[model samples]
Target chain A: MSNINFKNIKDRQFDAIVIGSGASGGWAAKEFAEKGLKTLVLERGRNVEHVKDYPTTNMYPYEFDHRLETTYTDKQINPIANSCYAYKEDSQHFFVKDHEHPYIQEKEFDWIRGYQVGGKSLLWARQTQRWSEYDFQGPERDGFAVDWPIRYDDIAPWYSYVERFVGISGNRDGLDTLPDGEFLPAFPLNPVEDHFRKSIQTKFKNRYIISARCAHLSKPEPIHIEQGRVQCQNRTLCQRGCPFGGYFSSNASTIPWALKTGNLTLRPHSVVHSIIYDDKAGKAIGVKVIDTESLEELDFFANVIFVNAATLNTNLILLNSKSNRFPNGLGNDNDLLGKYVAFHNYTARITAEYDGLLDYRTDGRNPAGGGYIPNFRNVRKQETDFLRGWAAGFGANRGNVQDRSGVGAELKTSLLDNSKWGNWNVHSHMMAETIPKEGNTVWLDAQKTDKWGVPLLHISIDYASDDWARRDDYYEQMTAMYEAAGFTNIKTSNDPRRPGNDIHEMGGVRMGHDVKTSLLNRWNQLHQCQNVYVTDGACMTSTGTQNPTLTYMALTARAVDHAVKSLKTGTI
Target chain B: MNGNRINRRAALRTMLYIAAGTMVLPACFRESGSKTIGLVNMTINEEQELLLAEVVETLIPSSQTPGAKELLLHLFVLKMVDDCHSPEDQRNFTEGLEGFAAMEDPATGTKFINLSPADRLRFLKQIGDQDNDKITMFYSMTKRRCIQGYMNSKNVMTDLKKYELIPGRYIADFKIG
Candidate 1:
């Protein structure tokens, strides 16, 4: 703390400067501010106040110009961002236009991002699950990529630490692969879903399906309640942002806490382009930033720098930051800064219709009503084909009467009349794990630059043969189980979907033991630069088949602790 | 006077005359064009709007609670179709209005409006159940559009059912069926 004397630059500099205010940046800011460090957090987009800024949260679909769907113009302007169903009129403002920051694709790659204060944390599907030993030790077991510097045991306490604060909602299923966390009560499954769960359990001895572990405050704990958060309203308009602070987001939780500390300084509309690496000092003294609104460049100095600008964006910044000592980029000694990119293989799910459940109806309309089956395939025993395993998230609900359609006077009359009948439907989605391939990477495109005059990322990637094989196996197994449960009109589909459709972008500047192979060390501290630490999805050694936000938060919290300790010990 | 001043004076006179003429136009024209119905805003004129509201109210009348009109279902449907529906669908909707006018009540040998409530319901049911593609498509379209309008209304979401802004605790054992 003495080494970082703000008195010397109280009129100019901060003790720490955190880049990107998404999941990781939010945590870093909160931790640094709480620890009494004068921290400055930079966000590329407009400041979004939790409830007030969520203009569409309380708005009904009928009120929207596109009725919760994307317009033709929106699709045309943002081909990649508009691919996801969530990227619609209701929440499109949260995302950046692809054309605005055009990235060349050597192969097709989807880089879905939200460049706001809360970042993608505002729009993330809050299915928070702990990565087991399998995820941490996958590289070691399969000898695919380098092994993870940290293991599940090392991060277990931090996971608990994050869950306790964020208020995760789940059941205490004592599974090894998908470990349970400090959870609020789990949401109930529909009657049909319960039947399917029981039947699947009986048919498959080792496999299990439990309720989805989400980050919604199902029940406000003492900490959550103290933070002035509320319960879930069951109005599944989460992407639009919850006005009640019912879900976990940087806007709803961390940023507000940091602001309350008064030690935090948040500069919105300021996009950090690169870290100013002082070659003589052998440290990152400050960061170079561009104001998205003003189109003006500025440099801010700080002792410690935390790059939480998501996965790809952080890599882009690091790669763009060129110095005399490190010509390739800062911490690019091995030239592995933006290589071995991995994203979840989403195309793995089986859908089926049930006849008897037509009469059964649930009163409350829950937008997020479903259960998840953890990865139980490759944990205790190994699969002959695939090394890693995947998990399934299934949801069941009664179809609305609005599902019916007609034309002319009859159509008009039927719509006006509410006494209509409809059938119930069940849907499911699977998040499959893909092995890290060195060929898949993100590099800088010299031709393209964003509105802020930063170099655009060139993503070159695709699903490997092993990923396709695993997806095939996933479809076959899921179909067999659904058929066994007596579900009729069963249709199974794999994610013929593109790379970024799942919205879980990982890898690129991954953590590893060997400096020659990876960018960051075990503590998420860059090998070449001691002062700079990246704790976003970029720090992930493996892309496990779970929502990665929770893990990112845990890592960010752990890294902040390490950074603070390192500062005290004169390591930086 | 200058050419621009002469032109401006002529334009102003023409605008005043048109505005005065529109004041005497048929109430339907004035009402239909004026109304702007949607989630955030509700702007509808008098006369037939009340009738439309009444028609929807009768279909889902108040029992223990307020009915469709109170829920602003008609307004919501109108706004959604006007704003949200695809331009092609909007064009189809205009053409479909002709099909609606062609509908006759057998009892009265007149349009649907001339019939009693019971007869109206009977006439609608018969046409609604028809297997013809055109008729079925019309029925399906109207049904879907109306449901979209009604269900998404704030009145329906908040007034009728239990609207939990946030159900803090998720009880897995709760009865979902």
Candidate 2:
């Protein structure tokens, strides 16, 4: 308490401290600041202000030095990061380079990362699907992972709350497996896609397809106008960072909203060392940080602290935080800090040509991707050998094929011709779910440390038997569906990309009912230390068959509300 | 505007042959100032650059509208190949360029640079049909870059294609007859 007398100590103290400035951390910042608490968000990377920081947002194809192509050197250097579909010349700056922060891969793992104020939120594909009761009860019903502490009913209102603010555009898809949320209008499916939907509905049993719900301002409400954003312009260049604030990002939405409250202090270039636990206080008091430029260590104190440093990083931070009472890690009682890590499987893809939709072609672009075939297998009962089911992204479009043959004036004429549209092509990629196991783990390396003296992470996660069986099932089912749709030349391929490339890695410090298996409780508060909350992907008990950002935002909002209430009642 | 179109490079090329040093080296032609500007990484000189420009001009010559050369696609090719291409592709291109002019026409027995326009076109078409290793690499790289540059240039995008920066709507069933 003697440090409280120092003038600088007051500047360093806050009502709440959030570890990261990513999707979940941004929500924590906004919610805490809006609730009249002085919030401090610590980001480990450079600050990226909203529209003004998007360097390549408005650039054309020709404006880029190589016509927006990923150069050979770029691919050679960043073999893993450049393998991502979004890692082009325009959006490459947002993605972290390969060797920028090295990690030990016991197995082949491509840890795709973005380190900045917005984090991966700026470069997200923006598919925001609400998890249903099926997802909440999966682990319990199937007897695989630990049961989720909170059910869909407990977090349904939070989903609606986050959806309204985040401006999720989706249809009220009436299904028990994939529940609907508060949404704006959905981006329409092309003719061929709609044809396939009709085909599957008439023929198959439970194959429900709808437009993938996405985080975009389709029709800006008064709240969105207040946030200073407009309707999405269908640019589909979202990885470059939307200049119009058409998409939701930490830089575009939550951070600015938190700053507008005048109670938020965003501290970039603060690499968090660990949570500082006080043995006498019997809880976490503050966080230790290493300045990115200087090697100096500093500490920031707060009454309540939120650890939302993505998923693997949140586990790393907690696993590194050591105290006299708990030397293993903060809130780690039963050695469950960095176990049961899982990621979504995005290996399989099926492409086919639909020649019937010759007269119909697509105009402009779809930022919401296309149609989403929600999890159909093992919804009501476990029909397959796998524990969980998989969702798929389906879209149909024609290419702007040119007859660029011959040399001289003939080539010139063909190159200028934009009227030649090729046959309509359809494609679908699986979002398979992998059951988390003890073998799939991430921990701090014994010897190697980063320049900041933090132990480098060593990841050892691989696909299980269920993952392989699901890939084969996806291939068999998709090929049959394509044949039924009267499509020809159906080609199915499973790209041999390793795990961690999906950017949906989750469940290390997971939330559950029992303290023996989980680190966080129902309210996302640490079991032993109630003041420290982890509401990011780290808090997920099980990975649902959907893009996990929407669930993360909902969980974060719910946890903040619980924290604020607990703070008032002196329970935290 | 017409009189001022010629830059200092053109003026220098037309007027002077400098005695830069008393001890001149054998490769003093590099100081002749005919080399194109602003390209980095790739090792290129004057004659090879002119040969690339002529190849681009031959690929998409001028007619009613601006051609590949008029749109400065040769500069784009050099820039892209220099910065964007692989080291192996760059090496192949450089090696292929050394033997480009010496490719004697089978019918006329004349060098490629000395042949008539029709004969030059036929020679390139014949060379393209054959799977000549280095020459094929050079041709493919040049053609791909030239077409990309020409199709995406401001003139083509604005006047010909009408690429909307913000297309506002996605028509699911747009008709094309």
Candidate 3:
């Protein structure tokens, strides 16, 4: 208690404390605040307000110094960040630069991170799809990781609650592989994409191509307008943070919504060191934090502490939280604090060209990025050499062709020429589900401590053979489908990248029924330590092919509901 | 930074009750002859900037519409090359500009800028023909930055292409034929 400022206990106390202000933590803050509980949210980075802070939101292409291209100096400094497609000059400020915080890579891993108050939610791709029962039963079917303590039915209502507020825009495709959720009007796919949908599904069984579901506002509802967000303007510059609040971000939606309740206190630049566990109480109570500006140490007392510091950092925080009772870490009686890690495989891609749709070209930018083909293989049962199948995005549009040959008015005329439209270029990328393995782990390095005195996280996650096999299956299936649809010049490439490049890493503190094998129980609570919940990506029992943000929000909302009721009944 | 410049320009246009297409250079060029704003990575004199301006203007001449020089795209090219390019490219660009800045006009015994526009174009063509790798490198680099700057110029986006800041509607099946 040497670091605890006891005299200021009244000011430092809270009903609920949330670490990180990204997708899940934002939901935790909103739910607890709406439930009439005073909440404190600790964000380790600067606060970025919605419209006022979106500096490049309305910037035209010409406004960018380098036309939004990554420069040599930028790549030299941000080797990990430059690898991300979203890390451009327009949104570079949102991503964490390598020089900002150093981490050891036992193997090459591109851990794309955004450290602002909104975290990576400010820069997410905004794809929000519901996970199905197949995903929940993945571990049980293939027997890889431990069985998930809860099923899709347990969290389905919470998904509806989250989707209604987050304003998910998706068509209910009546899918058993990818369940439908409460949604607004989905942006319609262009004629070519619809053509592919009609062509592929009629030829293949158990395969469907629906409009890609996203968090954008195709049409704003009353609840959305109440949050000061209007309809999406179709700018497609969402990576720069939409001024319309067209997309759901913590800065635009949850954090502000929680603030309006007057029960939330958001403390920015408060880097959380570790959770403080009480030795005799047999439960967790509060967290130790360091002021990022002055390095002044303090402790925040809370009845319930939710750890939603993304996936890897959550593991880092837990693994560094050594205590007298739990010597290895908090609730480390199982030694599963930083193991069974997995990520989505997104590097494999297939591209082709459609000669038709010559007259009908895509007009506007789709915030949804086009259509989605739900996971077709290993649904209801394992039907492939791989354990799980891949979900893919399908898109087709006309491209602009300008000859940059001659050096005069001919060139200028050619440059501004819009008369010549190229063939309808079609492409699809595989988002395959990777199996979680105990060998793929993230741990705190022994000797390397950061400026905050916390040990640097050592990330050693990699792909298994199933990942490569699944990629091959994706190429094979996509090629056959393209051939069926009369798409020519078809090419497929694996484009081997590191495992964590997908940025959907999960399962360092997975949920399970047994305390010996998992850290969290069914309600996202620590099996040994009550009053603490891990509802973010870290609690995922297995990685599903979906984006994972929507599921994280649903789990956080459900856990808050259960934890709040338990607090009233004195069971937690 | 460049980001702040864009916001300030947008906000200034909104507050000053001016249309967005106004790209006047404050009438300072006639009085001062040649002037520059700032540079972080590379050093350039007023003469060198003037020579670069000539290259951009020659690349895209002004007609009824604003050219690259009128839109101040040359400065953009400078900023991009300075902040965006590698040190080797920057060395070649600066060294290439120096070669043109010091070279005596063969027709008239003056510098390259003193020559007429027709002579300048011919001299540019002569330089283009030379096997000097640095000049060729400089010519191509300037051409690339010039074209990028010209196409993505505010004048081109707002006036020529009509870039919509808020399209509001996404016509999925827009007729293009």
Identify the candidate with maximal TM-score.
2
Residue A255, model 3: lDDT of: 95
What is candidate 3's CA lDDT for residue A289? 96
Docking class of 1: incorrect
* lDDT, candidate 2, A1-572, per-residue tens: 21233237778899999999989999999999999999989999889999888999998876676778887777888888888888999998898898788888999898888889989999999998988899999999999879999899999999989989999998987988888889999998889989999999998998978987899988989998898889999999999989889999998899999999999999888899999999999999999999797677889999999998889899999999999977889999888888999999999999999889788898888888899999998889988777788999999989787777688877778787777888888999999988988889999987889989999999999988889899999999999999999999999998777898888999889898878889999999999999999999988788988999999999999999999999999998
Model 2's C-alpha root-mean-square deviation from the true structure amounts to: 4.5
- Candidate 3, A1-572: lDDT as tens digits: 12534348797999999999999999999999999999999999999999899998878886665789988888898889998989998999999999889999999999999998899999999999999998898899888898988998999999999999999998988988889999999999898899999998899998899999999999989999999999998988888998989999999999999999999998888889999999887788899999888898989999899999999999989888889988888998878899999999898899999998788877667899999999988887777777888999899878678876545455577767778998889999999998888899989988989999989999998887888899889989999999999899999987667777888999899999989999999999999887999999999989888999999999999999999999999887
Q: Give the per-residue Cα lDDT of candidate 3 at A245.
A: 93
Q: Tell me the docking grade of candidate 3.
A: acceptable
lDDT of 1 by residue, A191-264 (tens): 77887889988989778878888888777888997777888777777899988788889999999999899889
Scored against the true structure, residue A104 in model 2 reaches a CA lDDT of 88
Which is superior by DockQ, 2 or 3? Answer: 2
Give model 3's share of reference contacts: 0.68
TM-score of each: 0.82, 0.94, 0.91
Candidate 2 chain A has its poorest 10 consecutive residues by lDDT at: A1-10
The lDDT values for all models are 0.75, 0.86, 0.86
Compute the interface RMSD for each candidate structure.
6.2, 1.4, 2.3
Q: Find the 10 residues in a row with the least total lDDT in model 1 chain A.
A: A403-412
Deviation (Å) of B72 in candidate 3: 3.2
Report the C-alpha displacement of residue A189, candidate 2, in angstroms. Answer: 0.9
